[model samples]
Target: MEEEECLSHSSPSTDNSLELRLQRVTAENIKTVRILVSSIFPVSYSDKFYQECMNNELTGVVIRNGEAIAIVAVKPENFETGRVLYIRSFGVHPRHREAGLGSFLMDFVDEKGKLLKLPHAMLHVQTSNKTAIEFYKNRGFNVDCLVPQYYQRCSPPDAFIMRKPFH
Candidate 1:
């Protein structure tokens, strides 16, 4: 993916009042990213996980009115002539929901993965989060399987392994 061109778009919202800019971020943009994403997640991650995401190279931050309102972090790999793009975490600020920020990030992920020649993008979402499940399903992601106790720390413990084939 072209780092400089990664700002997918910055069009105005439905009413053309606010502009949402999707910018690709590196390890240096960690502070705001961590704060924005942390506020959206229902559960808190360990410092190590946050640190990894902060230090992760493949991450995007959505900015609105000069503040970050959404983020999507990823870990990508190429193996055996096939490429895989994994979504580490995706979250949009509660106040920013329904503004299509999440959709933008999801679409960005798909586009980025395909551009990177990754045939598939994968992720695990908590089973109890029906909203997230529906959001992903509407975007062509299918539940590959159920991971029992996938989140050892979360109360629900179960997760849905979702995948979207881009090739």
Candidate 2:
């Protein structure tokens, strides 16, 4: 795996920062998030798909300094009568990578899930995306299953379903 340079952005501040708040996706932020997705992932959906996510209340964004640097879309599922938060899409802007922003955003979700009594958090990642795989693993995610050709539409890559039990 090739190591990419860690990108950094101005740290989020409370005084001048544009309220780095987490809110249900709005029409304005949905467009911005779509662009973000397209930039990070090879395959991304149309504007309507983003709008659907916003309408479904599955999307979230972190606004900092009046810019959306991180975003995630979660799909809550009932598995064995226990609620699991499936991280559908998650990304931080390239310029914001390795700035503790990704961990901060994920920690925010994990804290929220714990407060809501969600048992575990789940997500899928391309097998060849070693950087992302290692990042999640370092954060304590363990692989539960593998899917072949999972990203056929996006890339010719296999996928791994990972989960972390939030005790």
Candidate 3:
């Protein structure tokens, strides 16, 4: 929560009717990001947990009017993969899925990784979430491995460790 600078990023909507604006996310934006993320994956956690995630993570969010409808969080070089940008969390509000928001944020992350000299983007997704798996696959991500019990807090706690490398 050092510098809370807001930026506007425009992307296409689901209907391709209007442009959706995105911006940098800080600790103050965690509440809305959490809500968006929880809508996709509900986990019991506190503000401190999310605050830590946003402390230095590269997070982008789409706010409509006054509410966040999408969010993507990333951690730089904090993984076993050297020079990798790990996608800690990503989600679009249930009501806003299929909109170009997810793709836009993902493209932003790719650009972000390259900017930081990181070429890999990694994330863990529950195996049960077929929609998400397909979404990642369509975006050029591939399953690198299976993380058993990765989602221990949830039922069917297995996850696929997916990774996409920048060219």
Residue 158 in candidate 1, Cα distance off native in Å: 0.9
Candidate 2 per-residue C-alpha lDDT over 43-65 given as tens digits, one digit per residue, 9 for 90 to 100: 66666667666745456666544
Pairing residues by index, what is the TM-score of model 2?
0.77
| Candidate 2 displacement at residue 35 in angstroms | 1.0
Ten-residue stretch with the least lDDT total in model 1: 1-10
How well does candidate 2 score on lDDT at residue 29?
A: 59
- Model 2, residue 126: distance off in Å is 0.2
Q: For this target, which candidate reaches the highest lDDT against the unseen true structure?
A: 3
Error of 1 at 148 (Å): 0.7
Candidate 3, which ten residues in sequence have the lowest lDDT sum? 1-10
**Top TM-score hit:** 3
**Clashing residue pairs for model 1:** none
Instruction: Give Cα-based local distance difference scores for all models.
Output: 0.75, 0.70, 0.75
Instruction: Tell me which of candidates 1 and 2 scores higher on TM-score.
Output: 1
In model 3, state the lDDT of residue 110: 84
Whole-structure CA lDDT of model 2: 0.70
Clashes of 2: 0
Which model is ahead, 1 or 3, in terms of TM-score? 3
